[model samples]
Target chain A: MHKVVTVDMEKDILAENRRLADENRALLEEHDIRAFDFLGAIGSGKTLIIEKLVDHLKSKGKESAAIAGDVSGDDDYQRLVAHGIPAANISTGKECHLDAHLVDHALEDLPLDKIDYLFIENVGNLVCPVDFPLGSHVRVVVISVTEGDDMVRKHPAIFAFSDVIVINKIDLAEAMQVDPRILERDARRINPGAKIVKMDARHGNGLDDLISALGL
Target chain B: MHEFSVMSQIIEGLLEESKKWSAVKVEEVFLDLGDFTMLGEEQLKFSYEILSKDTILQGSTLTINHVKGTIECDCGFKGEMSPSEDSPHRIVPILECPKCRGPARIISGRECTIKNLRLVVPDV
Candidate 1:
């Protein structure tokens, strides 16, 4: 016996995203809160870069904080508290991705008016975050040379999603036989519009280029 | 990995939807699985079967229709992808249009959405 099935979907995801993102952008414009999202794979130094970014922003008399998403996110929360920067951790529990709803929830604790910059360090995954929008002004995708030469080829979604690509761990590039230029070339091929930065955060190299990208 | 999380939301949506009408048993749930997304159908169905059991959405079937990846060429032609059956493969022939042969910007994929919910409310 064959049975008939029909369905009615009330909400369309992309349409809803376009609509809600417009609303979030409007609120941000009204309040003057400039936000950026740091997205990358695990061990790619997204957290380290964001942590350093907070200090760099503070040196210029700009206040900034971070929203770290994790299963045990409060580690970053504690670190932020110790640094005297306001922060929160969106404990996604089992969710691999962070979305605008999570960002909206994280903002409840922030003084959006007082801060000049806000950073959202999303969960460390290339695939999941590519699909979700955080309502950020910029999406900075970080890739380390040590990960491999084929990173851009394997993760087009991540590269295409990037407004800026940070090729980190350059200090080890020579020993690892990793060419950062190749990364930039491939990124250019994938997303010609994205600016690429080569950095060794531990050595404080290329920090100025990053700051320039942030317009600070 | 995100499939489980999305499935949870779908179940929640279904439960809330079922409460709107009395004596209705869900027949089918239609969903759009984006090609850009990394969800697995086997994982989705297995998890959904377990998640929907004994709740308001008990015994419901999940149907996922995969949306094709469409890229529009710089030369004004568009078509579905024809990537080879290989792992770690880049999407190629790099947007060469069948007509004008130019680069293509991917227009689709990244649309992991729950499109429909079908239920049979008993004739009252």
Candidate 2:
């Protein structure tokens, strides 16, 4: 006769990803690399901000590398490489977020020894990326004013968990009829301890403030 | 969607657990899905149906028990939150404290886990 058996697993669904993230953290620490995971929605200017950060770091004599995670194209990867930064392109075939496993693989392709800083541009999504931690020292969430002031209120979890919140594209705030102060208030409300920075990454506005907020 | 990816991981865990139990067939999987996770139940079921095909977990019953989202405020208030009407979707939780109206820390609703499983095995 066949009998029924009950197994008490009580396991987290994302446990594997969490384990790998810890391993990635250890690996990064071993290599003395300060990695930042940039998360945002599409058109939030994550790539441009990263490019600007890389340039600033380079000018300070600090070498930087990047891993661009996209669903298909390597456009962001190309942009970073064109700016004279080492970057790896990860095409997350049907996945919406970059998990720690993917970052581990991308780390294999980078020159970890030569890099002082690493920027991981997660798949351009605010919602999905919130659940997956990619083993970065700092998690930066970039939201543009063009997306509207409700961006933070609508996606509170990402803003709440992130270490730094970047309100990019402030140059068009008036043209878009969006106020950066409202975004800052919302972010502060969601995460009081998080450092909030407003900037126009394209025009290099507020870059120094962002740099200071990042403790770079 | 990420539901497919999450379901894939669940299926892998189920299969491994079944092997440990020496089960001839898997029967049911119970999950505690938290409201704060923002994972769709229908999407998760659909993903399970697709990913479990031909595996030991095929045709298994997937039961999801939704856990209510809760938060704790620095002002010493703790409770659940109702979705704001302004939210685009009902699943998006309001992270502010109802009492203090300040940013509250999520205390429980973010969990996505396999609580347990049932298997069929030969009586030995």
Task: Give chain B TM-scores in order.
Answer: 0.77, 0.92
Interface DockQ per candidate: 0.35, 0.58
- Give candidate 1 misplaced runs (Cα > 4 Å): A1-5, A13-23, A81-83, B21-23, B72-106
Model 2 segments more than 4 A misplaced: B71-104
TM-score of 1: 0.84
The complex in candidate 2 yields a DockQ of 0.58
Best by DockQ: 2
- Per-candidate Cα lDDT values, in order, are 0.75, 0.88
